[model samples]
Structures are given as structure tokens and as C-alpha cells.
Target: MLGPKIREIREQLGLSQKQLAGEDMTRSYISLIEKGRAVPSQRMLKIIAKRLNTPMEYFLGESTATDTDIGEAVLDKAKLYYKERNDRACIRMAHNVLTLTKDVLDQTEAYLLIMRSYNRLGEYRQALDNGEAAAFIVTRTGDRERIVQYYLEMGRAAFHSELFHAARKFYEQAYTYSSRLKYLQDEHIRALIYLGTTHLRLGNVDQGLEFYLKAEKEARMAGQPELYGEITLGLGKAYYMSEQDGHMQLSYDWTKKSVDSYKLARSESYVLALHNLAVIQLHMGQKKEALPLLGECAGIYDERNLPHKKASILEEISKIYLEERELQQAETVIKEALQLLELRDEGVLRAKLYRLLGLVFHEKDNSDEGYYFLRMSHDLLKRIHAEREADISHQILQLSKQKQKMEYDDYKSYIR
Candidate 1:
């Protein structure tokens, strides 16, 4: 009878066992109580009541109830299905609870869990649909903190889909909610970081930098070194993308700081910091200095199974060879990079590789082949609307034309 009442109240509020647990207990433990196989401890009962916005006595059938006395066996089965990540089964069980009780919270929690499963499976639209429904229900119930988290989830989905503006909008809404709640310090920081990254993606560099700096200051004040390291990394990247030699050096300095902080914390954040530092060093004509850093980055990416990042580092190695006038070695390295790009199916990276190959051919005095590769790179970059690459491609085209004219003039002079 207690189990049935618990399930009834859970359904009436539309909360899933997992949601009711609220980071206090696992979904499996919640199921045992619902099945009458185990009675909830006093502490557990209080948590569930708080999560369901009900009284603990409600589970004991003390208050006026609006649900049937269904057996606890069905609840046990539902818990089992949930433990297996079977969203369909959970939804079915939630429907049964709904039939016996008009619990909006239970329904909302079931929908949210289903949405999360869909999100994990990459069904972005469906996930957004279900998440939006859950958010609507939560909003109506005035669960401000949960509503903010739901919006953040939606923002993450939008960010994954490359909808930067939409992601920013959602993140802003989440931030507003967090501010109103005033108790979610960590959540506010997370929202700020996402907002900063979104601005960076949208080419609003100054705005991005402002947000990152603000986050860094807040993190420092809060004694959160890890968050400080993260924001510092973002600041370094923003500087690197500025493309000025001075700013590139500044980028290297900031990244070095980030790497040191991360190392102190024994975190994996050093991987990206090292990679970015290598890039800046390469651009500064310190190929020898950059090599060891690139090697470290490659090893980390390899361990993480990030083949595309590994290939990118290989491409940088080829660039160094090209700059050093080692045409044969450059050609070999570029060929390896081409193979990697093919395997990874990375169009943007392949375009970069092609441009580097153009430089290699130009160095070998094969103007025609060099121009052809550069043109190919330019076309691909144009298709992607990569403004920085497009500008570089234009410069390459101008240089190629000048080189061709010089070669023709030399040929005429020799014949004369």
C-alpha cells in the first residue's frame, strides 16, 4: 500500500525515480522502495518528498490521496527497465502511473529522461522537443533552478548543431534564471563560459574576450583554479586568432600559464594548451621549439583517439619542413597528412593540407602544380566561408602570380 501510494504521488508530480533521487540516490535504489522490496529510510523518504513537493506522510497514505492502490510489482519492473537505460519501457511505466494518478511532476521527469536518452543518441530535434515539454511543465510548477538547467541543456544541443546564435540566446536565458536563483554559483560560471565560447564562434572576438576575462576574474575570486585555467585557455585562443605576431606571442604566454596551472591541478587541460602553444611557436618561426610541444599534443590526442587532431599536428610538421626548404621531406609528410585527412573525412583540414602542398610545390619550382593546388584550396575555403582562410588564399594567389611572372622573365633573359 505504501509502495502504491509512493508511485501514485511520484506520478501525480510527474517525477522520475531518478529525478526524485536528485543526486542523493541511484535510480536502482529508488526502484527497490517503489516495489515494496525495501522500505525507504527516513532520510530517503524526506528527499523524495522534497523532490516531489509533497509531505513524507503522503507516502504513508495519511493525507487525502488521488491514486489507485496498484501493486508494487509493476513499479519494480519499471525501475529495472530504467536501470537498463530503456527509455521506452520507462515511458510505458510512467503512462501506467499516470493512469492511476494525475501526477504532473512524474510525467515531466519521465519525459526529461526520455529526452536525455534521445540527446545521447544524437536525435537533436526530438531531444529538444521533449526537453522543451519538460521545461514547460517545470516552469509552470515554478522550479526555477531545474528550468535553468533545462535551458542550458537546450543550449548545448544548439551549440552541437552549429547554431551559435540560438545557443547564445538559450545560454543567456539560463544565465538570467541563474541570476534570479542566486544560489547557483557554479551554474552561473558554466553559463558564462558557454556564452563566451559562443561569441568567439560568431566572430565577435572583443565581446568573447570580455566575457572570458570576466569569467577568469570571477573564477579567481571564487578560488576555482580549474575554471580560471579554462578561461585563460580561451583568452589565449582569442589572441592567437588575432593573427598579429605580437598577439600570437601573447597567446603563447597565456597558454603557457594555463598549462602550468593545469599541471599543478593534474588535469588534462594541458593537452589543448600545449597544442595551441605549438601553433603559436610555429607561426613565430621557432620550429625547433614547437616540435616537442607538438609531439606531446600528438601523444595526448592519440591516447584520446582523436585522429583528426593528430593529423593536424602532422600537417604542422609538414609546414615546418616546407619552411626549412626540405622539399622531399615536406612532400612525404604532406602525403601522410593527405592520407589522414582522407581517413578522417575532414574537409577544412584537407583544404589546409592542400594549401600547404601548394607551398611545397612552389618551393620546388613547379609553379603550375602549385597554382592548381592553391586554387583548389581557395575554392574549398570559399565554400566554407572561412574568412581567415579565404584571405590567406587570396595572398597565396597573388604570390603565385608574381612567381610565375618572375619565372617567365628569367626564361626570356636566358634565351636572349
Candidate 2:
């Protein structure tokens, strides 16, 4: 059988099924083929033949493709997988291509693709490992453009891995290299954005702002809404995180600009920007303005079926109502938030909501219901061993007396 022959050859070459399958196929599929339980397709058979260095005729009495043709075909398939965002498949196909070619440029391209695939999969260390190999081979080709791309990909991996220092270095190299290439304006600007974010992560606020401002100029010139939104968002964060004079106001202004830009770009980050703007308004004591923004965010979260986020907004709204001494409004919002919590395992939030409900009852002079809800909050926090459980317990003890105090004392001395 073809399966027997394929297995025989594979074993002779001392290649595992994984190595034989490469990037275009799966190890399990190879196992099935070797076991004679599944037949390999003509295209797949050709790949197997090329990998095993045997002509296709040996398996199917046909020889329509050469080794070089198979190598190019595999590489093309790798590119297709990459385009489709099937990163694992792309990595396998790229690995296969490496086996069929000795050309430094082709090997470097394979390594670069592998690095990018690993990055997409959130395997940053593997991405960096492939990146090192790509960088080493790319230097021999003397291709400055590929070098720029390599650094950019490496920077992205490092950035996501929280290796800010390494990310900054790679992004700087990419920016410097892309600056020398007239056609790489987009890459140059992207490098500037990366540098800004990396510097911000490293707590270099002024340096981050400088990079962001430079990228902002390029983004405005390009008239790209999404790019402008990204830069403005970074600017907002830079201002928000700063302790400089009027920083809060500047943060609000930049954040408002970012929200507008993101809305124009139809970006999904619009809701998040709205939330940030609302928080900034609250910090500025513009509670009136913050309420409407919070309502808008709550509505969006509800429509998006993000129960936790909607409940969080409701909790904030309830807190504001409590602050205004609108007991009825606060109770209504708290009950709504509690209803949202019914299906969730969010013990912390549930406990907080119960505690708020207790406060509302206490404020209304309903001591019986107030202590009941407070005890409910305390029990939940204790069950979860939450960090604030002891504080809640102390508060409960202070608010209750006699029988209630004795019951809590027993719980504290025994259960605790």
C-alpha cells in the first residue's frame, strides 16, 4: 500500500510524522495516512513526496512537479495561510518551505513568517527566537527593508510580552531604518506609535509624549482616522498619568478628541473611550456631565450583552444616587445590578452590591433589613476569603449589638 511505502521511507529518513507534515498538514493526518486509515490527497501526496525526496510516480505513477516547484508551492500556501490568519497552519507551511530550500533569502522569509505567526499566537519567546534567526540570516541578504520589518515584528512581540526596554530598542531600530526608506512612511509612523507606547510603559512620560506628538503630525497629514485615534488615545493616557499642572483638564480634552476620532473611524474602542471620559469627568467634579456618559456606556454594554460591564456601570450610577441622598433611586439601581449578578460568579461585585443595599436600608432607618443585607455581604466576602472581609466584619460588629453582636462574635471566634 502507498501508506506502507510512505511510512517505510519516513522511518528510513528518521523523520517524525510532525517533521514530514511540516506547515501545510497535521501530524494526526500523517499518522492516519501512515496507518492506511486515510488516503492522502494528490496535493498532499506531492508534498509528502517532495519532503521524502522521492518522485510522485513512486506513490501514484505520476511526476508532474519538481522539488523547486514544490518548495515554491509550499511557500505560496504558507503566505495564503498567513493571509487567512490561520497562524498555526502558516507556521507549519513555512517550516515545510525551509526544508525544501537552502536559499538564505527564502530561509529568512520563512523565519520571519514563523516569528510573526508565533507573535499572533501570543508565544512571544518563540517569536523572539525565530526573530533572532531571521535577523541573523537577513543581514547576509543586505535587505534594509526586511530588516525594518523584522525589528517591527520583534518589537510587537516584546511589547505584548511586557518587555518594554527591548521593545523600545527594536522599535527605535525599525523607526531609524524605515526613516531611510522613502516608501516606508506608514511603517515609520507605526514605529513612532510603538515607541510612544513602549516609553509610556517604561514610565518615561515626556519621551512618550514626544513620540506620540511626532506620530500625531504624521497621522494628521495622512488623514487616517484610526491612526489619529490611536495617537490621541496615547496622548490622553500620557496626560492622565502625568502629575503636571492642569493634567486632568488636558487629559479630558485629549480623551474627548480620541473618542471623536475613534467614532469617526468606527472603532470598537469607542465604548472604552466613553468610559474613560466619564471617569475623567467624575474626577473633575463634573458629576452632571459624567452621568449622561455613564448612561450611554451602560446602554451600550447592555446592548452588547456585556453583563459585568453593564452591572459595573449600574453600581457606579447607584453610588452617585446614594451620594445625592436619592435613596429610592439608589435602591432601584442596586436591585437592577443585583439581578445582573444572579447568573454571574462575580462574588466580589455581588458582595459590594449587597453592602450598598445594606447602606440604603440603613439610611432609610430599616435596621432589620439593613443588618440582614449587611450580614449577607459579610458572609459572601468571608466565603471568598476576600482581602476586605475583616474590614466588613468589623463594620458589621460596630453597626450591630446584643444578639447580633453575640452571633457575630461566635462566628468570629469559631468559623473565622
Best by TM-score: 1
Residue-wise lDDT of candidate 1 within 56-170, one digit each (tens)? 7767665544352341344455556777988677657754654554343444445555555556555667767766656645454334456567777788777655566788898
Q: Report the error of model 1 at residue 396, Å.
A: 4.1
Candidate 2 on 332-405: residue-level lDDT in tens? 99999888877543666787778777767776777678778878887876654453443554465465543332
List TM-scores for all candidates, in order: 0.64, 0.56
Residue 140 error, candidate 1, Å: 4.9
Query: What C-alpha lDDT does candidate 1 achieve relative to the native structure?
Result: 0.69
lDDT for position 327 in model 1: 77
> Candidate 2, clashing residue pairs?
23-92, 23-93
Query: Lowest summed lDDT over 10 consecutive residues: which window, candidate 2?
Result: 407-416
The 0-to-1 C-alpha lDDT of every candidate, in the order given, reads: 0.69, 0.76
